[model samples]
Target: MRVLVAGATGVVGRALLPLLTSVGHEVTALSRTPRQGTVVADALDRSALHRAVREAAPDAVVHLLTAIPAEVNPRRLARDFALTNRLRTEGTRNLYEAARDAGATKVVAQGLAYAYDPEGEGPATEDAPLWRRPPRQFAPVLAALRELEERTTDAGGTVLRLGHLYGPGSSYAADGSFVRQVRAGKVPLVGGGGSVFSFTHAHDAATAVVAALDKPHTGPLNIVDDTPVPLRDWLPELARMLDAPAPKAAPAVLARMAVGGWGVAFMSKLRGADNARARLSLDWRPRYPVWREGFAAELNGTSDGTQG
Candidate 1:
């Protein structure tokens, strides 16, 4: 199979190219900037993307475009995710349309697993409703995600709803912003930290994309790990791993003032996602089934932090 991968320089994309090749698939990288043999085009730019996709003439298309900032401000969550939101919404539409026009048989695009409503339950399944009424700063982000998923599914594509990514080139890396904040004791447990978190390594995410191409699955699939841990459980351990002070507890009201309503909800009200459908449908399993091993390997220098 010939595959065209957008966001080819991203964390997951960097890892995906090699894996696709290893499995006997020829891959073409689509990028905004010039590279050795990459199809140079920005996903947001429809004409350029159409030309690039037509030129690649792939059998499958993988949309992994995102522009999340390294240092995100919780108080300004929407502002931080503005460009990424566009990538999910407008960028997704352009890519899917282009893929169809180019005669791509399969499309695999990215989605979020942790964006489910916080109403109830253990871990959210793929069918669970997204947050209908979220914090002010998070509304647009959710709207964009919904649009991405709807558009991809309309094109008969698969949407891999990945969990909180934490690996090399991710925000949770040893040298990442999250780690820096944890080291400085800036990340706190808000409202007892009841919210659950499902994590995914960048490599695992890349492999899932490969599986999506081979499988007959369409619509949204939750691609996450086995364990769904809470902030109260993971935060302290992460701090210890970094040899940093334990995270302190903050009252919900105070945290709301400090990081805004979205931050509070993220820490205390967010729900984790279940990956049973993905496991059964794709015959896929996360290499690092739990956050503990993956985190330790990445932070302790045992791993180079690349998805590969």
Candidate 2:
């Protein structure tokens, strides 16, 4: 199959290019700066996106645009994610429209598994309602996610609701801000830290995308590791792996003040996702079935912190 990937320079996109090539698929990466045989387009710019897609004439289009902050500070993180929200909402529309015009039948886009309703027990399944009334300010984030998924499915595309990505080139990477902050004892354990989080190795995530490529999917599918652990369990282990001080505990009052309402809610309410659907539908399993191995490999320098 011929695939056109926007955001080719992003964490997952960088890894996906080679993955598709290795599988004998012809892949074209859309970049701001065009190179030999690559498509050039900014995903936010609808006209350019459509033109590039039309020119590439791919059978499938992959949307991987993101604008996460370089620094991990709360202010910067909030500001940067707003940009990502736009990418998920507006940027997604552009991709879908472009893909349709380009005669592409399948559009594979990224979504987050952590956005599901926090009320559910264990890992949230694909059918679980996303936080419709998220903690005040968090509504837009989840709303954007829903919009992206709806747009993708409306176009007869597949949405991969990936878990929190780790491994190399991600927030958990050696040089990533999360590691730097944790080493500095800046990230705190909030309100007992019971909130669960699913994780995915970036390499495994790219492989999942490949698996979904040929599969017939029209709705959201969770792509996560086998284990879904809580912050209390993973947080301290991550700190230990970094050889850093354990995260300080914060009471509800202080936690809300420190990271704001949404931050507190994220650490206290966000639930993990169940990947049963992805495993069955995509015929795939994570390379790192547990985040422990993946995190340890990246932190301990076993994984080169490249790829995704």
Candidate 3:
């Protein structure tokens, strides 16, 4: 297969590019910055992106562009997400156009699993309705996701709804801001710490993206791990592994005051995703099946070298 990968320098993209080539697929990587063998173009520029993909004439295109800032002011996620929301909505359209112009038959676009409504229980499947009615703050993100999903599916492509991304180059990484905050006892366990999350290591997520390219689909597929753990469970364990100070519990009111309402919602209400569809259809499973063990492996800088 001949493939075109946008955002080739991103966390998952970095991993996916090599994985694609190792599997014997001809890969055309796109990056804003010039690199050997990578097509240079602004992913949001429809004309430039189209020209790049057309020249490559790829059979598939993977859209992985995101503009999340390095330094996160938790109080400002709504503000911080503005650019990334545009990337998701506008950039996705541009990439889809590029793929279409290039005559690519398969497209695997990036999506979020945590955008589902938090009212229900258990892990959310692709059928769950996204948080459409909102305080308007989170509406942009949800709207972008909805647009991206619909556009990809309408174009006869697949959407990969990924879990909270971890592993290297992410905020949850060993030397990341979140780890530092935990070590300094800055991140508090809000209320009962009830929010559930399914995590994805960058490598595993990359593997899933590659798997999605191989599988034919026109719907959203959750690409998450087997275990769905709550914040209260993982935070303490992560602290323990980092030898960091244990997080202090904050009442709902106080936690909201500390991290803002959105942060609190993330800690106390967000639900996890179920990856059964990806598992069966893609014939793939996470390399790190559970995050508890995965955290140690990532933090300790060790790998079992298996795409578990």
Instruction: Highest TM-score: give the candidate number.
Output: 1
Backbone clash tally (model 3): 2
Clashing pairs in 3: 286-308, 287-308
lDDT of each: 0.90, 0.84, 0.83
The better-scoring model by TM-score among 1 and 3 is 1
What is the lDDT ranking, best to worst?
A: 1, 2, 3
Candidate 2 least-lDDT 10 residues: 71-80
Best by lDDT: 1
Stretch of 10 with least lDDT, candidate 3: 299-308
List candidate 1 segments past 4 Å from native: 305-308
Model 2 spans > 4 angstroms off = 72-78, 304-308
For candidate 2, list the clashing residue pairs, or say none.
none
33-143 per-residue lDDT for model 3 (tens digits): 778878888877888877888888999988888888877665787788888888788888888888887789998888888888988879999898887564345667678
**C-alpha positional error of residue 132 in candidate 1 after TM-score superposition, expressed in Å:** 1.6
lDDT of 3: 0.83
Quote the lDDT for 167 in model 1: 79
lDDT by residue (33-52, candidate 1, tens digit) is 88876899989899999999
Give per-model TM-scores: 0.97, 0.95, 0.95
